[model samples]
Target chain A: MATKKFMFLNRKAPYGTVYALESLEVVLIGAAFEQDVSLAFIGDGVYQIAKNQNTDGIGMKNFSPTYKALGDYEVTKLYVEKESLEARGLTLDDLMDLTWEDEDDDYAEKPSIRLVSAAELAAVFDEQDVVLSF
Target chain B: MKYSIMVNEGPYTHQASDTALHFCKAALEAGHEIFRVFFYHDGVNNGTRFTVPPQDDRNIQQEWSKLASAHDIDLVVCIAAAQRRGIMDADEAKRQGIDGNNIAPGFRISGLGQLIEGGIIADRQLVFGD
Candidate 1:
């Protein structure tokens, strides 16, 4: 089958619900297929990748570190809605640094998180062949 | 068109499973091909065979099982999600050092990759959850 753009939409707060974690599981598993995979953090989903996540109090595994490993899986393109972040009182600085290595460009590291406005994200959504929401 | 359906919530607690079943029935009746129905998150709960719902209400898991058998549909429960939710098959049960399995007939535990594969193969992919 041809490579289709599978964009996963994360719209919930991490740890509060299992959507963010389960969606990441899909993204990690999707890497082996080598398809064009991308993830969007909209609304409260922006907190999913917020740095300094400590789950010691919650008794749940802190899966926040997994987001960093997504780069190794070749599953880049983490889009954070600018409006969503601001609405949540967060900024790009609040998120973890997620980057992928470019093997052809002397293995240069490039940022994977793209901060897009809701308007710009609409275009991104239109380009997706499949949009899986969580 | 070949279609893939995804259910992201459990039965009774949410309407996603019901909506997905309805969509599948309607799609099949309209003569569209259902490539697969993927259960993820709480949706994996739809594959458990241990449910004992009130007699009057519908048995969502059994309904999915019956629909899959009659239509040769593939019902896949995401293994990771299933494992997390204690929805195990015989193999998984044994692997996890458990005594028995609760997977409904016509359903199998598989990787999330199956969901992505369906997206690639299906002409249309419908998601039935928040």
Candidate 2:
């Protein structure tokens, strides 16, 4: 099949629901098909990649580390809405440093997180052929 | 145009499944082709054969089965999600060394790849969920 622009819209928080983790599973499996895959974090979804997430007391497996491996699968584009982060009293420093290696550029690591405004994210969403929400 | 559907919630609890069913019926009635209906998360429960709703109420699983039978639609349940929720077919149940299977007709357990493919193969894909 021909590759299409696929975006997974994450609008929910982490562990309280299964959407965050299951959304990641679809992204990983979708990567093997080599589509133009991107992930957008909006609303409470921005909390999914919050750094230093310790789930020991919650008794749930911490899957935040899986976001780091997304780059390896060539699922590079990750857009986070700036307004959402600011609304939740968070800054870029609060998120994990997710980056991708540019194989052609001497394997230099480049940031994958593109913090955008609501308007900018709307344009991104308009370009997708498919968008699945979690 | 060809379309694909993703259902993220199960029967009765959330309206996602019912909404998807109505949309599918409407789409088919309008002469559009439905490439597939991929059920995931709690939506896998829609494919269980053991669900027995009140007779007066709509039988969610049976409705999907009848739709699939009439339209030849592909109803796919994610295997990983099904295993987590115990929605199994005979093959899956036997493979897992279990005694019984509860998958409804017109549905088959597959992989997340099928979900991705549904999006890729169809002209448009719709997701019904929270």
Q: Considering every candidate listed, which one attains the maximal TM-score?
A: 2
Query: Which has the greatest lDDT?
Result: 2
Per-residue lDDT tens digits for candidate 1, residues A56-107, read 9989999888898888988879999999999888888988999999888998
| TM-scores of the models, in the order given | 0.95, 0.99
Candidate 1 structure quality by residue, lDDT tens digits, B14-129:
99899899999999999999999999989999999999999999999999999999999999999988998999999999999999999999999998889999999999999998
Model 2 chain A poorest 10 in a row by lDDT:
A27-36
Off by over 4 Å in 1: none
Tell me the TM-score of model 1.
0.95
On a 0 to 100 scale, what is the lDDT of residue A122 in model 1? 94
Task: Judge candidate 2 against the unseen true structure and give its global Cα lDDT, from 0 to 1.
Answer: 0.96
Return the TM-score for candidate 2, rounded to 2 decimals: 0.99
